[model samples]
Target: MDAAMFSIGNSSSASDNETVVIASNEDLYSYAERVVAAVICSIICIFGSIGNSLVIIAVLLSRKLHTPPNVFVVSLATADLLTSLFLIWDVVALLSSDGWPLPNAKWLCTMTSFVIFVCIGTSLSNLAAISLNRYILITKPYRTYQRIYSPVNIGLMVIFTWICPNLLSLLLSLTKIVGFGYNRKYFICCHFGQQPEDELLFILSDVLLIFIVLVVVVLSYIFVLKHVRQHFKGKRRREVQGIVMQASTSGNDTERQDRQRSTTAENSISQPDPSGQPIRRRENYKDLQVTKNLLLVVVVFFVCFLPYSFLIIFPRSDSFHLYAILLALMNSCVNPVIYARRHPHFKIVLSAMIKCQYQNIPEPTGIAKRFFSRGINPIL
Candidate 1:
């Protein structure tokens, strides 16, 4: 009987030990998840903040980049900068024992959600504004776009971009029409813990807004493309006419001599401007290139934001939702890359800054140089 009782006690002790081991394993898994999430957020914050800051500084320092359209770019960069800064809180919240660092503070969640919404909304609005600006400038250059997008007007637009989203978000939060709080599953504070009806309403409203903005952007690009095609066709036609005119008149010796002299004069006129200055054609080309770069920005914004937006509409699993949010955050890091690649002036400036070789660079030689020489400091 003593042996049997001892055996029973041993069995009970073993079962308790197994239970403790299982609980420990679960805790370890949770801890690992938090660490991984925190690490990812940290990387995103560092990269995004650096890239966006560089863009803002480059634009400020480069007079050439201070054009009307670039005002929107600056605003976008600011929004992205704020986004990167705000993501630090996400990291902190994730690392906390309760997933939300300030779990007892409801206002922190509300404020965080509000700020995130505003930044994201402003980013999207700025992209849409850029697309519309390009469309008007390219497709309807003869219209009142110049007057409409004057510096003061542009400033107002920028102000509106910042204000409208924030005001709306604040109103929604204050009224309790929508809700925001910590989501334990996603380990982030955002639009969560709402009534089912209210959540649906919020999602639908967000979807509608996104749809409208996307439609505007898409249509603007479509018209811009058509205009560009027509412009090239007309230019080609004029070139062909000039060649035919020269050929037809070439048969008469006297006329050919006169025409040759005229052609020589024209060629001289077409040569690079005095002092290696950019010509009107080169200026126009630079503008077109910048427009293309901005269009790329719009495209990148769309691609990055779409996953999160769709997940909101479709209501995905928690893991998928987390990934979607991460993808959206990555947009802040990518815009600078797009700028560096597409904007020649930006690339030159960035390279100069990186290498600390900001002096005594030769003047730009041709149309290519037009991209680098315009009002941008050649050195430093």
Candidate 2:
């Protein structure tokens, strides 16, 4: 892991002043700025690595978290981990120097740029897969369990997400088109070139990819919210009806007693009241609500990814520096926080991981085991 970190760190600062970025000529001042950037990057990379590493470990060790969605989450964390260690670390190193001091080679620079870009793309792709998964589960229930939990299907989706972006980045890198003109003033590594068309292609591909993912994510949440609201609303009504029925029954019983005491001349046998009607409506409603709440995972995906979309696509000379970096870095920190917030079980799991007091919880049955009793299900 340390080796991998160093390799990526070495790659990050491979490019310098030749990229045509914001200009700053002061040597000492530049050194201070680069130091600060490295510190920030190190902090983010260290914590991000620890958190994502825990996710992978917990999923592997604890049978409970090894579900289809967690599978994608593992991928997401893996991609982010690579980006922070490799690209962000490089950026930190470059902020001080005008250019890469190490051996400069065409292939090295190209490979470094390619690797860093792919890592970013992979993160977005995994998120998109997650959103699509949630959408299917909520919107199309009959097929959800069958298609979603299949190991074959899940594996393919993961592979597709990982592979597609590198292919896209390869095409972009080959063009030798620099998108954003020199941004030497603030940071380094993977800064776009001056060619508007090249930059536009890169931006379009990124936006298109992210935009699709965000759309699916947002739409999934919207459906989830609608379903939950209707369900809870029905539950509230049923609860009220139940109370009214109890009151009415008590009143009837009292009246019957009063009649019997007042006029014993006509004794009447009483029959048991019919069984209370089944609360099928309420049960269905509750199911919908629970399903919707689960879809919050998709919401997290959108929130983590949105800033990068807006910042990258719309480059501005007057852009805010800290804000841009924050938006990018937020993607690194958001996942663990979201998992902790939304999944109560995950909080306990994450805490256990942090304290190094991991317990052996029996693996929850796989999704397929729960729903598919006898036969294999196909998902294409």
What tens digits encode model 1's per-residue C-alpha lDDT throughout 1-380? Answer: 11211222132436554445335434434767768878888888898898888877666555656677788988999999888887888887777764456757756765666677788889878988899888777655333677889889999999998998888777766655555655544556666424344656667656666778899999998977776666565546555767777677777788676866677555433433322321223226776888788888888888887877787766434346677777888888888888877786677755655564444222423432454456443333
Query: By summed lDDT, which 10 consecutive residues of candidate 2 come out lowest?
Result: 265-274
TM-scores for the candidates = 0.78, 0.70
Give the poorly placed runs of model 1, Cα more than 4 Å off: 1-31, 103-109, 253-283, 360-380
**CA lDDT for candidate 1:** 0.68
Q: What is the per-residue lDDT of model 2 for residues 1-380, given as tens digits with 9 covering 90 to 100?
A: 11211122222444343232323324223566557666767767777776667666656555667667678889988887776566553554355354443434434444555566687778777766765665455444434555666999889988988899877765654554432212344444554543444556656766787777677767766765565455445546555655555556565777765654433221111111122122232224434443444455455545655666676655552244434554576566566766665564566666655654433224524543332343332110
Backbone steric clashes in candidate 2, count: 12
Best by lDDT: 1
Kindly give the number of clashing pairs for every candidate.
Answer: 0, 12
Model 1 is weakest, by summed lDDT over 10 consecutive residues, at 1-10
Model 1, total clashes: 0
* Cα lDDT, model 2, residue 47: 71
